[model samples]
Target: MFFLKDLPTRQMLQTYHERYPGMNAEAVAEALRLLRRGSLLMRALEAYFTAHTLSQTRFLVLIVIDREPGQEGLLASAIADRLDISRPVVTETVKALVQAGLLGSVPAPGDGRAKRLTLTLAGRAVLADLLPGYFALIADFMAREGDGTA
Candidate 1:
């Protein structure tokens, strides 16, 4: 219930300390440390994606497209649902990717009203170039700090 960053983390959580005397504040301290670590890691990933001509949202769109049926791709509505983002946001991302020559949109093979997205040669190359680093970051983080190995 604490803001968690209201106090310099080296400072003990007074609420936890005072609410239950003799109970060590180690739990609160550990939680704070984990939160800070997760936050910084997310920031680092965001920066890496941004600097490399990719955004996580759009990258996710690409991933969905690759994973979906036909490797042919899905409609914006399907992508929005799969990514748990807004339809409008998905639309914009698809447009940008299409413009960047990373994605191509065409009439859905079965549905005239919907557009199917497919990655182009350049898109595949971009994904190939970016995936190794992204996987490395995840692997390194989990290897070093993740608690659940099972």
Candidate 2:
């Protein structure tokens, strides 16, 4: 079976030239490279997360809550804002983490309706366990890129 990365750049340029006529081959090649790299990184992350029984969003939420200072934790809205994602998405992710016992929520001191999220012991432990490997993988990738082998 043919793979995207297996396709030669010259062949890609020729195919794009045939299809789009005036399309810029250099721009198309760069975009294809970026897309392939993104796909590889995402698949790697997905596999890692799946092995740990964690979703990327849930892991991100846990990290956000864990990084918050003091014992009060953070609001779901705050997480949404920090992650630049929608409130509903944060809410759903928080719900899943809470259900999994990885997160705890309490009513905000001044606001009865607002809940502040905090990482549970399990959450902290999981993050601590996974972070070393995650950091190592990133470091390795960076090193490879630095050596022009990526």
| lDDT to native, each model | 0.79, 0.79
TM-scores vs. true structure, each candidate: 0.74, 0.78
Tell me the tens digit of each residue's lDDT in model 2 across 1-150: 113764346786888799989898877666666666666666677678889999777888888877777878998888988897888888888888899999998888898879988989998999999999778876766665453223
Q: Alpha carbon lDDT of residue 86, candidate 1?
A: 80
Kindly give the stretch of ten consecutive residues in candidate 2 with the minimal lDDT sum.
141-150
- Show pairs that collide, candidate 2: none
Candidate 2 lDDT at 55 equals 71
lDDT of 1: 0.79
Model 1 RMSD in Å is: 4.5
Residue clash pairs of candidate 1? none
lDDT of 1 by residue, 1-150 (tens): 233444344344666677779866876566666676676567667788999988888888888887775876678888888888888898899999999999989998767889988889898898899999999987887677665322
TM-score of 2: 0.78
